[model samples]
Target: MKGIKFDGNHSYDAYQLFLNSYSIGEAEPNTNLVEIPGVDGAVDFTEYFGGVTYKSRILKMQFTFIADRFGLNAAYAKLQNALNGRRVKIVLDDDREYFYTGRVSVGALSPDGQIGEVTLTATCDPYKYKTKVRTATCYGHTVGKGVGTVDSPTVTLIHASVTNTGGAPAVPTFNGDKAFYVTATERHAGGSSDTFLNESESLPSGKDTAISGVEIPAGATQEFGFCCVGEGDLTVTIKLQERSL
Candidate 1:
């Protein structure tokens, strides 16, 4: 047996690359060898359909578990919160969604008792995005005139007792004349007041039309062809913005 010399001073030729039990930078030399490592993770998803284009958001999470005598291989993340990490969902409701899951990644393992970052990621396809447009159409409106000219027309809202019986946001809004729903105030002023007359529920600020609302949800839609008494041309436009989880 050739005597492999153990020189107290690590030899650059071999000691430089020698495997050790613990990380090298310990305040005091720790003989611990079974320490596991560090960790990291990520997820991606895309969505197409329901009138929405594409939106993405990352739900970041941290994994800080040092391996005990057992080993880092035993480290585990339930990922119940977010499997493929969280992305933005347009639907404003409490939902426990099932995300994606990929292979596990360990932290950068240190040779000399150093720790490694274990990273795992779950990627998905456009989870959800949409334009929630809250509105109702009253066809036979008398077609209010310059009322669309930011002139707060004296005409009252079409449906005095009108109620949108749906889910979640039940009472869309019917304040004043016609403000059950919420939108930008510009639509009222900048809109074509010649004859094409219509009003949307004002946003939280009491402004109508200027801003757009989300697309209608996936469910039974309330249909109304005309408002007989004073019929007018009604049009609806929905605008959407990207959001995070």
Candidate 2:
């Protein structure tokens, strides 16, 4: 863990500093650098005219303790052993350059005597990089529209190259190289009868708000979002789960 030469005042070498400064989580040994920002004499190119932005994909992996009761039993112990300390890997497409060697903790455990909904927060490594995000457009076709309550303007759409940007998804797999998995389709206050809506999903895994699906109704901003690292001929189709509502 030593070799690079430093000028002065820098506590550690750039490599060491970089590793400590940014976290890819213990489970993920490392993360793909989206961009270097100011390195290599790279200028600030923020748009299509400036240049193109290709960002590293941020992915999430989840584990659950599906026990019917509280701990102190073989079940709880089994759950602990399953994910108490585990390494997770996020694979990048094409080049095979990916991140790996991270761990999981039971820290998301709920408190005792807490019945019903006991939700614990699972904290993983925050993702950081200096890459660009490519801008792409997905197609959408309505399935169940003009239905539901008059007050509630709901439109169930299959994953039609377009669905949502962010939602409280329990899984962490992408639809393709640039799309996350689509979920239960419902209504959206998307601009008029026929048009595209602007939806924004979470950026990678560590920088802002954690939002479940948006409550599409009056007074809501149409969002803009895309899937994670989806590969191949990316085609999205989201169907409304009748069992849901």
Candidate 3:
């Protein structure tokens, strides 16, 4: 686990002196599987009855630490700071990374006066822990000029938004094989879009505002294109991450 690393505003091994046992919580699906009322016993109706979503519950975790008065105090301080509500990333056994982004509450503290060791328990809010993250960038393109592309390296859910600080209306195209577009009616206002694709997607100047989802296969490069619809410049930002299968 030499490559194993972590940072919760600090290094993971920084607490090695006090660190005892660490374990990750189980992962649950972020979707609802509903059953159809009139289905026959031979067929599973629930599989076709409801909508599935991408939101996950908090990722529960536990860590045990053994330390003395000074070590205990230092460990407490580090965990205390993490409780301020920022996410803490942990690289589990050099496998993958997970974050404690919600709540991190400390359990009861136990002290061994004679041995000078303290035991502590910590809990994290539920979350479908995230894996590695990657980024892609797209430059602004004027309306009717050409399309812009944003690429990704894995099967990912692309979260993207574009801000037009300039004084003009614009339309962005999201294209892979099929095309999706977003339109802005006024100037200086910002608009954003999200899509998942394996190959590529483009944004063109148009008046349609409907958005859709796309699939980005693993190791595939996805692209996003844009064009000015009115009179100002556009700035596009895109984020990509692999989704739990």
* TM-score for each of the candidates: 0.23, 0.20, 0.44
lDDT for each candidate structure = 0.27, 0.29, 0.37
Model 2 clash number: 43
lDDT of 1 by residue, 1-245 (tens): 11111112221132122222111111221122333345233221222222223222222222333444244333323222222333322111122122221222223433224432332222223332222343444443533322233233533233221222322222122222322232222124555222112343122222333323323233333222212123353433222221212
By TM-score rank, best first, the candidates go 3, 1, 2
- Top of the candidates by TM-score: 3
- Candidate 3's displacement at residue 99, Å, is 3.8
Q: Show the lowest summed lDDT stretch of 10 residues, model 2.
A: 236-245
Candidates sorted by lDDT, best first: 3, 2, 1
Report the poorest 10 consecutive residues by lDDT, candidate 1: 1-10
List model 2 lDDT by residue over 133-164, tens digit each.
22333444222222222111333332332222
Kindly list the per-residue Cα lDDT of model 3 for residues 127-240, writing each as its tens digit: 323433222222332332223433322212223334422122222333321133232222234754433222233443222222444334434444444333232334433333
